[model samples]
Target chain A: MLIERKWKKWVFFYLPMAVFIVFTLFPFYWMAITAFRPDNELYATWRQPNAAPLWTLHPTLEHFVGLMKTTAFPTWLWNTMAIALVATGISLVCGMFAGYALARLKFRGSEFLGTAIFITYLVPQTLLFIPLADIVRDLQLGNTPWALMLTYPTFLIPFCTWLLMGYFKTIPKELEECARIDGATRFGAMVRIIFPVAIPGILSAGIFAFTLSWNEFIYALIFMSSADQKTVPVGVVSELIRGDIFFWGQLMMGALLGSVPVAIVYSFFVEYYVTGLTGSVKG
Target chain B: MAIVTIRDLNKKYENGFHAVKDVNLEIRDKEFMVLVGPSGCGKTTTLRMVAGLEEITSGEIRIGERVVNDLPPMDRDIAMVFQNYALYPHKTVFDNMAFGLQMRKYPKDEVLKRVRDAADILGIEALLERKPRQLSGGQRQRVAVGRAIVRHPQVFLFDEPLSNLDAKLRVQMRVELKRLHERLETTAIYVTHDQVEAMTLGTRVVVMKDGYVQQVGEPLVLYGQPANKFVAGFIGSPAMNFVDVSISGDGRHAETEGLRLNVPDRIRAHGGKRLTLGVRPEALRIANGSDEHGFATKVDVVEPLGNEILLNFRAGGAPMVARVDPGVRLKAHESVRFAVDPERLHFFDATSEAAL
Candidate 1:
């Protein structure tokens, strides 16, 4: 009877979870194997004697070596990291103030202003990049990391603001009022009491902003022309495919390495991210 | 330790909600003044305005000798405890208590001493290192109160600080709060919807309704000689039952749907007019057979509350509760009669609701 119960539990819970894991991991498995497979094996027809599309008989690190040594992959990585970090920092500061004002302050047009900000977020980036591209050229910032860094906030700020606004709303208004009555000014209350209490939410917004900017593509593709100036997404796509001749191994290697940073960020702050989204400020 | 004077204070929200209208109050030093009312009755709004948390739409508020109409909350020299406790969730009990001193630029040693003193007073010394989320509801409320006391402000404002606790804890905390008020002896303005809290904790109680101050006086005065039907009803448990009655043509009695009551002689000038007759549940008793001026009623329900029995009965076409001896074995649907204390009968102008 116990064994039957255990079997039923496995079928109901573990089986579906294992299937989902495999389904999600299959694409990464294909990417990593292709990155390691020798060029001959990778391109060999299925009819070849030793050809196996799913697995490689002899794996090599040549693509990884080539990606690092032959290309400006390091420079691109540094550029992407620097631009995403700076943009996220700028967006977080602005979003914190804007979110607090929209959520707490009773100013004229506050509701209208909050709606206006959310509307800006709903404007598709595919269309925004056109006017943004023109502005980038006008400022002579094309081919520079500044182009992406400055433009990323146009969308990231709105996203962060809305997220943080929702988070700020969950906190009881009496906390701030009590702080004020406890002898802190409004700004002081926000800095000492509210910000500290909202750290999880802030961290969540920061993570979201970082991940969004890290994986951003359209603006990076339009603005940066230099190999070293490009972000991970634009750099790998632009450099690995020359006139329709794809360097599949190098492409896959770049993709695999490029995603590791974001994955690391998610893993380290996953608890904070969940709490931030749920926004449990118990007082 | 300061007198708070509010003169002609009014509050009108931007969206055109008149939350408080023409409220005037003079709270003496070291007095515990409780503002009691139903929800949306402007009691909390009036307290918030004094704390400077809500902007005053008109009139003047003076704390001591200074008019604080334009002062920010930090400069108001008052602390408020909210219903939800409102402790800083991220801070430990010690830091939460010290935050006010630190913000006022108190020296480090002084901040520690004051916060520690407050912790000691509140008996939360061992919980100093624990965050608010780690504490129970009652403990968090203590920390919230401790945070307020550390500053030694001139006045303390409490906004229903015990409404969150369970029944047993609420009684315990209520007693503790009363004791704390006496020890501190600071002027406090408390707001609560619970009439029992107002009666027990307040030296003076102000009853408000619909943005208007209905009555303000000592708790017993508000209970025994309420200024209006609203205060008479709002200031008691098992609220004062009211029935519409017309003064009889004889000039010394009143009549309702199915009964007649001897109108107290003091209200004789109101003869031949419609009025509201108010009587508290405790002022009623089961009538013995020979009792005069007793009205017949049918027992609807019997709620035996250990010490006293609350007999629900239909009298004069209205449902009412009469507090009687618990030994009275009454059952539902039984016929009974109750006699009210003639002197305790309240007469109010039917149209204005003002006590006559």
Candidate 2:
């Protein structure tokens, strides 16, 4: 009876985890399989079991090789990297100072300002595309990375500032008070004391900003009229379709490559990313 | 060394709640002054005001003759140890101790020397390389003290610094703090709600209640001659017992429900009025059958410590506790005769609760 009960409990615990793994990971599995499949095998119908590739068929890197040479994939990758890095950098510098102020300092209308920033974040990027396109034209930033750089922080800063405010608040007020009493000025205390302790929160905010800027499509599509200036998201989608005949293999490859930098960034700061993102959810 | 003076210090919160009301205190140089009271008693508010953490509502604070009302905390040239230790979690112990000196832009070698010297004094030299999270609670406390010691500030403000430690470590740290204060010869203003900590560590204790200073004196003086019922009840461990009694004569003698006692000449002038009798637990003794001064009571509980026994009993329909030798074998429901030491007895005006 005890053995049966123990087995039942173990099964209950593992069931949801197993379901989640299969449900979420199946697409990536199919992508990997298609990425490695030869062009002839990729077209094989799965409806007839025997028509699909069997053990006898050899795998090929033809899609990956074709993906590299046939498109402006490298330039799109570089553009994505540059815009994401610069946007994340700008967001981080602005977010840290703004976050620290919101968390610690007493200033006039701070609550109103914080709420205003958060509300601004709730406004969808898609809704601002037309207005932002005109603004980009007015600023002469059209068909340039500057348009994307200028647009990304609009979404990033408010959320990032709110994220870091929650993180900074968790740090004991006494730690900063101790610094102040020890003859360190407010700025000195923040730099020497509070910032070091809040590194995980800052890292998560940086990753969030980077990922948002990298994956952004609406502004990039609307603002970048030239193909040379297109980011990976817009570039990949536009290039995949020519007169309604879709290139699935190359399109999937572009999608896969586009996600790699964010995945790598997530992996490097996965612990901090989880903590930092969850920290913002409460605020 | 510095004489710290606070004149009519007041802190009225934004919502118009007055936390500290016209508090005035003069702490002598090298004196370990302890500000003690229950929570929300304005003791901590006063300490923070002194440390420049809280802005003074309307008052002057002078540290060694320099009016510090308008100065920011960094400009006050004082060191503080927080109740939570407040060690920078990301920094090594050595860096934590050297932080103040570095902030003052002291040269690297001088900062290192002072940090090392403080670490040696606190016996934390071996743990200097470890982060705050790596150290034990007691070690962290010592590091907090070391952080202050390295500064060598004119005054040190400690806000319940040892309140976070375990009982044994708190007792140990209390002794270490006393010795440190003696060696440093700095004006130290410590705050705690623990009367034992206040009594043991304070050269002079300032007792506060409801944003008002009740009394300030040596520990024994406050214990023996409390200014009011609050101080009498607040100072002792079992707390001094209070019972309503009516004075019949010119305040020479008083009578209650099941007890009668002769009031001392000091209280004679306030006779023919209602009063409250205050007696410390240690002042009450098991009376011999022949003793003239005695009261009989039924024991409700008996708690035995290794060195002493605390007897909880009821006298005149009022709860009372008596501290006795551990060998005394009194049991619950047993009737016992006890005597209150006349010299240790305290009397307060019934209505005002102020000492008569």
Candidate 3:
């Protein structure tokens, strides 16, 4: 019976888990292998003898070196970093205040407003970019980093607000009330008590916003026209794959490098991110 | 000087729930006043209104001599301990206790001294550097209390502060809170649904039901001479037994199924009228044979508690329990006679359910 149970456990849990891990991670593994494979091997047909399509005998850094030397990858990385950071900061501040107000304050239309904000978040960015493009052009922000930095918050704010609002609700309201009675004003209580307690939620929201803005495509593509002003995702796709010909090695190299910052960010706050999403406050 | 007065207080939510109705109270300096009732009885709502945490629909609150109706909680010089303690999870015990003093911009050394002093009194001086999540429930309670006492506000508001603790810890904290009140002498208004806590902790207890004040008096006075049926039923443990009975034509005796007792002379005018009679469990005793005034009934269940025994049986066609001497042995379904003092009887008008 115990042996059967163990066998069942492997089939139901571990076997499926292994399949899922490979399924999700196989793309990244493929990217790394292709980026490191020599040009001759990468282009070689699988039908050729000793072609080794899956595994390469020879690995080289030529793709990474060539991509950096020939393209505006460095500028794209810097632009993505600067835009995502500013955009995340802006969204976090707005979301914190809006979320707190929606969660704690008792104003007329508060529930209606909460649902309305969430509805705005549900509106697809695909449809929003057209009208936003017109506005961005009218504001004379096109072809500059300001265009993406300002427009990224349009969706980022609502996402952050909804997440942080749910998080703030999980924090006991009594903490703020006790603070108010302990001599702090309403605003003071929010800043001192609610905000500090909500750091985990805020960090999670910020990380999400950073990742979203970092990997954002449509807005960065539409707003930034200059080679140096373009963000990583748009820059890589636009610059590397010219005409119908694809620079598979360079493209894969760019993909791998573009994700490192976000990976580091996620790793740094992974503990807080989990707790924030789960919305657990000790008191 | 720190007397807190509440006049004609009312709270009606936008959803049209009338939570508190024309409540009036005066909490004297150095007095421990408790507002108690079942859930939704407006006890916590009334306390929150006084704490400025809830908006009062119409009321005037005065702290000291000032009419503080428009004042914020901080300006009113009041502090509150919530049911969940509401300690800042990120802060150490010292910071939690010192938060109020620091907010008021007290000097650095003075804040430290006051926090240390309050922590010492609560016997939590050893745990000052730990976070609230690290402390036990009882320790967190002390820290919450310490936070309130460190400020020495004009009045302290406790919203069922001990309800979260286990029963044993609750009892321990109750005595400690009472002793703390005696030592500090700050006017306080505490809210709870537990009758025992109200009776033991409050110098004066206010009983509420359905958004109305049922009775406000000393715990024993509320117990002995309750203003109405609700007060009488709510103030005691095991509750006062109520039986519907009709008075006999002689203007002296009241009768019901399986029970007969004399109506006190003061309420004899209720003769020939259907009324409700109430008797507390402790008032009944096992009667010896040949006791003319005793009523005979079969015991349904005998619970022999160590110090006393509880006899459960049907009286007036309703289940009733009697507290009696543990020395007298009894068995379920066995015939027994029980006697009650005439003065211990309580009569209420059947229609109004008001004490007669």
Candidate 4:
């Protein structure tokens, strides 16, 4: 009787977990099946009796081949990688220093500056596109990747700095005081002690900055008007559609390919990324 | 070894709050001095001023022969072990101990040698490769001491380094620190709110209260000859008991509720009609018969502490405790006679609270 009751309790606990697994996993399973399905099989109607089985059909690599050939997918991937890497690099440097200053240093306007930086992060990027576009034009950066580089960091820096400021503050002040008394100048202490201790925070902020720049659509769409200058999002949306009739197979194929780099990045540093995102949420 | 002198040290916060006021002290070479008080008594502030960690509002601090009020902490050549242990969390114990030496640009062999020597002395040699998080609380504390030991600074500063440990470990570390001090022969200044730690570890203990130095002497000197009421109350466990009393008959005797006491001629020479009488818990004994200095009181509470029994009772409407022989069977709600040891009694001026 006791064993039976324990079995009943186990079932009760696992039912929701089983239901959630099916709910979230079904779509990804479907996407994988669709990605491998032949164009004929996908277009075939399922209304008729004795219809051909979707599972029994042979998979084709035609969409993948067509995606690579017809669109500027390779160039777009290269452009995205370059812009994201550079933007993430710039954001990390700015954010770490600003975060340390906000966390440890006492100055006249420190609190006000920290608040202002966080407020800037809350301001919508869409609101700044026009002003940023004008600045890009004034700087004669139209039809150039420099426009995206300049625009991406504006969104990334404030949020990264705010996120890291919270992480830096969690470190005990005594740790830094110990370093200062050990004959380190303030900057030396921060660089040697604080930065190493906050590596997980730094990586998390870097991933956010990278992915934000990688998947960014609006600024890339509005800023870079030329074909060679377009990032992955803008390039894919532009090249995959010619007016209304959609290139569903190739468009899906391009998206599948476009997502691989980020997926690989996520897979490699998934632990740090998850910790970083959760840490940012708490902040 | 170097002597540290702090002259007329004053520390005032921005809002006109004085945390330490006109403090003065001189620590000789190889002397182990403990600054002890209750919380917010400016003991830690005084130590920080000596270490150059806190700025002095006015006055001067000299280490050896050089004036150091304007110098930074790094230039002061003083190593501090914080209450929290403050070992670099990301670094291994070896790195934490070697940090100060590396910062001073000591040769690699010399840094390694000093770190190893400190680790050996602290009995943490095997834990050197571990991070601070991996070690126990005691081990982390030893690492913090090791960090300071490697510096071999002119003066060592410890701010309640044993307060984080359990009672047993605190006592154990107190003994170890004293032994280490003797072995190193370095001038050391320690701050603790625990009177036991201060009494056990310091060659000379400075008792402080309300931002002023109450007394400075050897542990027993402060215990036997407290300079003021605050010192009398602060320097002993269970604290000294006080009673309001008035003197008459040309100051030959003093009277309070429930009893009358003969005054010592030495105390009468100070010439005060009203005073506070201080008697340590051990100074009061169960009187065998009626004595001139004996008083009758009701035993309200009895706490047996193995070695001694703390008897809490009411005398003249004020609560008091007496440490008595444990074999003496005493119960609550019963009456007993207690005699104050005339020579051990301390007299303090009612207005100034100064010792008479």
User: How does each model score on lDDT?
Assistant: 0.91, 0.88, 0.92, 0.86
lDDT of 2 by residue, A201-244 (tens): 99999998999899998988988877778889998889777879
List model 3 lDDT by residue over A1-283, tens digit each: 9999999999999999999999999998999999999889998888999978779689999999998999999999999999999999999999999999999988999999999999998889999999999999999999988898899999999999999999999999999998888889999999999999999999999999999999999998888888999999999999998999999999999999999999999999999999999999997
DockQ measured for candidate 2: 0.56
Tens digits of per-residue lDDT, candidate 3, B1-356, equal 69988899999999999999999998888899999999999999999888888888998888899988777888889889989999999999999999999999999999999999998999999999999999999999999999999998889899999999999999999999999999998999999999999999999999999999988999999999998889999988788888899998887888987778876798777778998889999998888765567788999988998998888988888778898887888899999888887888988889888888
The prediction achieving the highest lDDT against the true structure is: 3
What does DockQ come to for candidate 4? Answer: 0.48
Q: Candidate 4 chain B: worst 10 consecutive residues by lDDT?
A: B263-272
lDDT of model 4, residue A58: 67
Single out the weakest 10-residue window by summed lDDT for candidate 3 chain B.
B285-294
Q: Model 2 in CAPRI terms: which quality?
A: medium
For residues B1-356, what per-residue lDDT tens digits would candidate 1 score against the true structure?
49999999999998899999999999999999999999999999999999998899999999999999999998989988989988888788898889888888899999999988988998999999998889999999899899888889899999999999998999999999999999999999999999999999999999999999998899999999999988998888898988888898766888978888887788887778888888899999888877798898888888999999998887777778998888899898999888876898998899898998
DockQ ranking of the models: 3, 1, 2, 4
DockQ of each: 0.84, 0.56, 0.90, 0.48
Best by DockQ: 3
- Give me candidate 3's interface root-mean-square deviation: 0.6
Question: How do all models score by TM-score?
Answer: 0.96, 0.96, 0.98, 0.94
What RMSD, rounded to one decimal, does every model reach? 1.9, 2.4, 1.3, 2.7
**Candidates' chain B TM-scores in the order shown:** 0.98, 0.98, 0.98, 0.97
Across B1-356, the per-residue lDDT of candidate 2 in tens digits comes to 59999999899998888999889999999999999999999999999999989889998999997999989898888899998899998889998898888888999999989998998899988998998888899999999999998988999999999988999999999999999888999999999999999999999999999899999999999998899999999998999988888887767677888898766778777778888889889999899866787888899999998799999998866898999988899889999899876777888988889987
Q: Which fraction of the native contacts appears in each prediction?
A: 0.94, 0.76, 0.94, 0.62
- What stretches of model 1 exceed 4 Å from their correct place? A1-13, A47-52
- How far out, in Å, is residue B174 in model 4? 0.7
